[model samples]
Target: MTLREIMRYAGTLYSANVAASVVTFGVTVLISRDISRADLGIYGLFQAYFLFGAYASSFGLAPATVKWVASGAVDDGEFLTFMALRLAGISGLLYVAAGVAYLLSFKVLAVALFALPAYQVFSVGLSAARARLWRRREALVLVFASLVTSAWIFALLLAHHGYWAPILGQVLGAYSTAFVMIAYVMTRNLPRLRWPGAWRRAFWGTALPVFLGSAVFAIGELADRLVIRHVLGLADLGVYVMALTLFNVLNKPVHMLSRVLLSHFSQADHGVGHAGALEIVRINLVVLPLMGLAAAAVLPWIMPFLLNRDYAQAFPVFAVLTVVILVKAIELVQSSVAVAQNSATSNMRAQVVALAAYGMAVFFLTRAFGLIGVAWAVVLRWTVLTVVQRLDLKRRGVDILPSHLLVRASVAYLVALAFFPIAPWFMGIAYLALGAVFRLWRAPRAWRLAIGRAQN
Candidate 1:
């Protein structure tokens, strides 16, 4: 609401993310350089499985916790106790699944990826404890653990042989992240238990719909990998995975920014007096495009250095994905509004439409054009989702599209793209220059608004 509060929220997110991103980006760059394309692809397949398993394990409880916890309607200790129980149960289930997959076939390791879930559940517990304490710094510690562990494992991977590096690195990192959270909890003296009521409500209220939506979301996201693995083999999947990793980076800021928005906006008053929705829109406008242009300029330069020359072809893939990030940024901000309104059902509907459109587009396009078509399909999917989400928000009297914001975004991106191919360093300059120009163009209005809110 206030500039201080807004900044505190933003700072909490970006600071922790900056640490994690630096480590991730560094390791990714190193791994991309050191590992063969085929190895990378194999690792990617494993990662895909891990992400799926992790999300499934959470049962959507992560996002739901942010919502319910932010509302301050429940006892912190009680909620955390409940979260601990659910997480432990989920972790146990995941281990069982992993064991079965291992016994069935080596291939099932890709689907039954246990390490991510094992790490994620503990990470979830830490996050829940942080929510209870309202301690942002404490929350950040887990991220730091992830970063350090990832870097160490990445280095180890460079020394080691086989696909096991990625699996081990990720699984070990998950464990480290969980351990940090658990340690923090013990120090805080938060009550830990296998509480039944909290578990029931959390699953019913948060996890179930989320799991359904995640499955749909995962299908759309993982389709290319599935197709590539089955059709073209691990080598082709390697190329695709390289491109996908860049997209994931581009998507992270949007994802984190959305979390910050959901955490605060969901709890704040949303009446006419609040203008919470409008404020959210303004903040997003100021934020998303600036980040997008930065990506456009930075990725091309970095990709060559990170990946093997064979993967140079993925530059275009990166470009297409940058567009996807911009579009997704729009959708993410809008989705925050839906979350703020407690309209999970509406959010689910929107995801369904986007997923269907994405799947169809990818199927047709990929069939005709191969891997490049898959990239284009991603762009198309995000574009359509942005439009649909905007319409939905408009009906709710939330205006996310600002003309001036669009103008600024277009100008900044065009300028960055022009400089991108010519000189990466120059593109960085363009980002700074354009960022300054955009800030002046907006007259520090957002900043001023934040200040005013903070003072109030």
Candidate 2:
């Protein structure tokens, strides 16, 4: 796809993502305000555990589908069938194990295990659409799922269902959308469900490393919350989770871009060496840091209305967490590049090292500084991951970002965070205006080159 096409799709996907984030944010606000802090913390833990289980059961099939389909290396129908069957079998075993172990409440376990196969199916279906360059379909499916889930949650809450409301809503929405998407794909593609023997091997070859990487990464993602809950108790965990909930708004665009880039980069002849990678990095450098600044600036005003005064202390931690977004945006691009180059194992190794470091950092940091320390620990992990991934890309002869860009963006983010407590709106507007100027200065040149490439 041309850069113009990617931008168009990015806009659509980001809009859908924004809508989903808004709905999820509303749910977060409702839970934070109406529900007790301890219950909110339990909800947080439920989410964490469900994500880990879902990712584990997926076994990296979603990205594997994207990579194979985008690269024209596998039949979509065959791969989809394989994935569905595998996910179903694994999820059934997971349900049995959960039942035996009593890992979560019956409500939580039902949603986590039963809904997961459908969710993974939906995810793979969406990835398949993305791989086929069906951007609108991809966006629509995601929007549909998120909206349905949010509506269900709202309805359940109104009906006076307690914490189980959201979980049940999620399960209902996931299954409903999964069946719809599956039917759509069957009708649209008429994909034959034959096993492609060699391609099946090839898929596992790519997916296994990613599965290990993602599994370990999932653990790391949950580590902060788990450690906080264990070390500081549920109230502090609720506070930290609230901060994360707010920071997720900034993360929505980054997630959307990663999906677009993974598909685009996988198809690029030069992979990460293509000019598009550098353009992506440049765009993110301006957009992400400014987003962090804006969040820090506006969150103080918004928190009073959105959250209870009990969560008042979470705002500073939220501000600190925004910087993690900038670092994470960079890492997202790097990991996408690695995947594009079929060097997922290298990225996996980097993540393993980063996760270990993160685990240790979160343990000590939470002990020392409480909630803020947890935010700093996350920042430290992402920074280290960014460095490692950058070096990996450099070794692969793909230096998409200059060292100065990263250093400047990091410093700007810190300065914005520091200033937020003193002059929230001014710092926010000032940094956002600077980012706009930077975009205006750089975007035209980038687009010219992209257009020139496309024309040639």
Candidate 3:
């Protein structure tokens, strides 16, 4: 696809993501406000386990599916069959694990384990849809599923169901999406399932490192929550989780852009080897830090009203986390480049080192400081990952941003941080104005080139 086409598709996907994110954010706010803080903390704990289970059951198969489907190396039916077989094997083990947890009276852990297969199925379906460039269909699926989940949870809350409402709503949503996607696939002229030896080998070969890396990263992501729960208690965990939820909502646009760029860069011509990577770096540098500043400026005032006055304490944690979001946005672009280049090992190594560092940092930092330390630990982890990924890309001859651009962006971020506490509204307005100036100066030429390419 031409650059214009990619941008158009990215815009579509971003719109869909934004809509879903907005609804999801609303649902989260409702849950936080309505549910007890201790229940919210339990929910957060369940989520951490759910994420771990989902990533573990995926075994990197989702990305493998995307890579192969985009490259036209695997037929849909064959890929589906492979995923089914893999899911069966993984689910069996997970079921046993869940049973053991249940026997031990670990209800939430068991529930999270039971939800794994459906989560993986829904995830893989989305991956497949993206690989096929079915952005509208993918968007519809996501929005519809989120709406269903939100509605169910709302109904349960109205009926006076407690924490189980969201948990069950999540499981129901996963199954609903999985059923719809599977039915859609069945409507296609897909061949009967068969065991294909070569494809199995190919899938596992590509997936193992991605799986290991994702699993490690997933564990690292949960470390802070676990520490808070153990050391600080459930109410604090609830506050931190709510803060992170807000961070995720604010960071959704960058996440969507990175998702689109992964597929776009995978297929685009890289004659000089760094065109896609450089474009991603430049775009993120312009967009992410500004978004982070805006969030930092606004979240402090809005969060209390959104959740409760009790959550007002989470503002400082949220502000520190905006830096984490900024750094993560850049790191995500680099990681997408690595994925697109079929150099998953590079990312795997970077994630391994970063996860180790994150684990150690969270342990000590949470001991020294409370929830704020967890936020800072996250920023430190992402910074290390970004630096390592940049070095890896540089060694591979990719032209990253110039040092001057990095310095300028860093200075702008520091200035925004300094201004946040004193005059947050002014900080937001000034950052937006600077972002506007940067876009006006930089984007026109890029748009012209994209249009030229599209016309050609």
Candidate 4:
């Protein structure tokens, strides 16, 4: 597909994601007012486990699937084998989480255990559809899943089911997505567990680094919640989780953009793709920080309107973590370049270093300063990740950005942030003016032209 086509498809996918995110966000907002903070915290831990399980069990199968399907290496038999591979790899994670859930008793969280792998199935289907550029089908699947989840949660909430409303609702929603996706894919072909000798090793070789890298990152994420829950109790964890939920709602645009960026990056020649991705990095260097400023300015004001007084403490954590979205957006673009270049070990290296930093800091920080320190530690981890990934990309000749530009952008963003609490409207205006001074106001046109020129 041309840059135009990929972007058009991205727009469609983004719309679907927005709709789904809105539904989930609406439920979250409603429940935030009604649900106990501790219950919210439990749901937060459930999410931590879900994310860890999904990534740990994936074995890089999701990306590998995208690579294979997008690269046209997956014929009928190949697709069947891939599907079988995904199922097999995902089962152990389900079993382990289920056992934990049972030990905790048949609670709202048991639903969490089931949903972990269920989400993987949902993810795999989307990965496949995304690789094939099946825009409409993928959109429908996402929207339907969100609708089902919202329906379940609302019903349960009205029936006075408490936390189970969101917990089981999320689980069933994941299953709904998986069911619809599997039903569609099954009509095309059946899954088969094949004993292909050489190709199997070849696939694993390509995927293992990605899997390990993702697993390490997932461990940090899940472990952070565990520690927080153990020390500060569920209330703290809930507040933190609530912050993330809100942040994610605001950050969905970048998330939506990332959904197709890997496909778009992979669709082109490696050098061209890397360049295209770096171009985006350049634009985001201006766009993201200011975006963060805008969010930082308003999120404090918005939190009260969204949540009641019970979760007022969440605001501090949320304020500290606003930088996460900015850093993550850059990492997303850089990550695509790493994966597309087929030097996946670079990702492992960067993530390993970041994980080590997070591991060292989270324990001490959580103990000392509560969730605020934990929040800062989370910030440190992603900042390290972006820096390490930048180094790796440059070593591989990806030309991430010039040092001068990086420094200037960093300083400018920091300056804007420093002025924000004093006079936010003025800060926003100053930030926009700086972006204009850098000629980043023309980025929309520049990005389009660059994409066209850089695409193969």
Candidate 5:
């Protein structure tokens, strides 16, 4: 796809994603305030398993789906046959593993394990939708529908059931999306249940490294929550989970944007080549700082209002997480290099290293300082990731954007950091104004370019 088409698709994807994220955030705030600490602790424990499931379920099928579909390996019946066999075999084994765990009363582990392949199934369909391109609007619709329904479920559960409500909503939402994906596949007339025929080799060969890489990545993030539970106790785990939820909200906008952007990059001319990579970086620089400023300004009152008054203490955690986000954002810019080079292996390897760094940092830090040390560990990991990836990308001759832009963006971020001590309300207003004016300024040019691109 051309750059303009990519941007257009990204914008649409972001609109849908942002809507879902906002609702999820709102629900999270409510849960954090109302749910008991012990319940939240249970939730956090389960979530680690869920994350592991998410990583495992994909069995690396996501990138594989994206790769083959984009490469036109599945333009006919044979490709579909191969994919169906692979998914069936993988999903079957996964379900067996999940059933065993569930029957054993390993609820957290079971839920997470089952959810992994379930999530992967959903991701594969979503990736297929992107590959098809014409299916983009439909994919967004399914996602939005699932989000709205999930939110409704959560709200109802909160009034009647409390802790179980969020999990019910989460499971329903996940399955709802999965169902939509399956329907999309059937309707598209892709090949269904053909002979397995070399499917294992193709699927396993691609997924093993990616799976291992993702496992490490999962451990990096999940270890923090696990540590909090073990060292600091479940109450602390609950509190930290709430803090992480808020932190996730802070990160979601940019992350959603990044996902949409990456989908485009996956199919980019020359596969997100140097110039395309630079353009993506430029857009991120413009968008992410503004997002950070906006987050800093509004989160205090937002925390109290959305969650309960009890969560006001989470503000410091929110602040630390926001900075952690910026660190990761820098690393993402470098990751564009790995993506463009068609080296998922390299990306996976880098993630492994980052995971190890993060795990070690969290272990020591949490032992010494509790939550704050854990937070610091996150910051350390992000820093290490950025530096390590930059060095790796540079040595590989894949430095897409100029160093000066990086310097300027870093300086801008530092200035925004100065606004933290400002009253939340005032800071929010200022950032809101800044975002408004920036959007207004860009509108006329953006419109003209839109017209020009269309006419061309």
Candidate 6:
């Protein structure tokens, strides 16, 4: 496929994922409104733990699967079966661990633990859909899963399950998606379960690098929860988690872009480096800030309207995290290209460095600045990460970002942040004016021309 075709596929799925994520985001709104701060904290911890658990156990299998199938290095059935058995064994250990938690009197989290297996199954299947470029199927499955999460949460909330409501809702939605994914596989005729033949080396090559590098990053992503709980207390964690909930809603598009880009980069050999990198960076610079600024514009109203006073304190943290968005948007391009080029260690190294910086940051910043400090520390983590990854890319002849454009995006963010605490309305206006001055939207046309040249 050409770069254009890859981008087109990414666009199609991005639109669909956005529509589905809107419905899913409503579940977050409902949960935040309905639960108390302590309950909210407990719920947030549940999500963070299970999500990390899933990512850790899956061991980058999702991206690895995308690389394998997209590159035509593995048969879909054998690989799928390989993943299922592998995860099944891990699930057994997880179940045992959850049982131990229950015995230790953490009943709520223990029951919620079942979501891990559900997520594993869903990811294994979704990886197949992405590999085959089954865009419509992927979109429909996403829609179905998201709707299930929404409907189940609504039902559970009305039934007064408290924190248990959202937890159970996620468990059910994941299992529901897992069921649908199973059907997708059955339609293709299940391959006889067998050991790896020629694909073993390819399998480990992608999986090990991805897992080793990403595991530390995953820990960093969840570390804030632990820090907040220990230093500030559970209610404070709940307050901070509220900000993350909003951020995740807007982050759906970024996630979609990475998934699609990995497939594209795996297939298209010509635009795998410098020029391809530039186009994606430009696209993210246009989209991420727009999402953050727009989301920021409504927060002064939405926080008060949707949440209680206690939970509404997430505003400052949410605001600071918006700055992180400016940096994070470009990561999809850097990461996808690195993995596609078989340089997952670059990501591994970057994540290690960032996580270390983030640890010290949380230690000092949380003490000095409180929750907002934790938030700024997160911004610091991503900034360090992006710089490290960009340097690695440069060494490989993939200069993913231009200095001027990077500065433009950073300047626009600083302007927005400067005015944000005073008046979010002004922040929006300032960002828009800066965006105009910077001509952020002009990248698309240039990106098209660039891709055209690179593809040729």
In terms of lDDT, which candidate is strongest?
Answer: 6
Output the lDDT of residue 206, model 4. 58
TM-scores of all predicted structures: 0.84, 0.91, 0.91, 0.89, 0.83, 0.91
Predictions ranked by lDDT, top down?
6, 2, 3, 4, 1, 5
Off by over 4 Å in 3: 192-194, 197-199, 396-408, 428-443, 447-456
What is the C-alpha lDDT profile of model 1 across 67-120, one tens digit per residue?
677667666667767766777787677778777887888653734466756566
Better of 2 and 3 by lDDT: 2
lDDT of each candidate versus the true structure: 0.64, 0.76, 0.74, 0.74, 0.63, 0.79
lDDT (tens digit, per residue) of candidate 4 on 249-282: 6676676667677777777776667555555666
Q: How far in Å is the alpha carbon of 40 misplaced in model 6?
A: 0.4
Q: After superposition, how far is residue 396 of candidate 1 from its true place, in Å?
A: 6.2
- The TM-score of predicted model 1 comes to 0.84
Per-residue alpha-carbon lDDT of candidate 5 for residues 1-456, written as tens digits (9 for 90 to 100): 544665676667666666777667667766666678877888877777788667756667665565556655444465566666767887788789989998999866776666555566666667666656744664475456557555766766657545566665666667667777678667865544455445456545555666777777777778888888888888888878877877776675565445445555555555335555555554554556566667766776556655543655456666666666655555664654455345556567777778778876787888887787888788777666666666666777666655444444544455456567765445434533543443422444444444445321
Clashing pairs in 6: none
Which pairs in model 5 have colliding backbones? 53-116, 57-116, 57-117
Off by over 4 Å in 1: 107-112, 129-135, 191-203, 272-274, 305-308, 390-443, 450-456
lDDT of 6 by residue, 1-456 (tens): 555666667777778867877777777777887887778888888887886777677778888889888899786567756887788897897889889889999876686676788788788678778988998888788778888878888899999847888888888888888887777667875777766677777778888878877778779878998899999998898888888988887777777778888887888774544566676676677667877877877876766776645565687788788887788777778888888888887888899989989998787999898899999899889888888887887787766577566567888888877877677777767876887798765654756644665452
Better of 1 and 3 by TM-score: 3
Backbone Cα, N, C clashes tallied per candidate: 4, 0, 0, 0, 3, 0
Model 6 error, position 395 (Å)? 3.4
Model 4: lDDT to the true structure: 0.74
lDDT of 1: 0.64
Greater TM-score among 4 and 5 belongs to 4
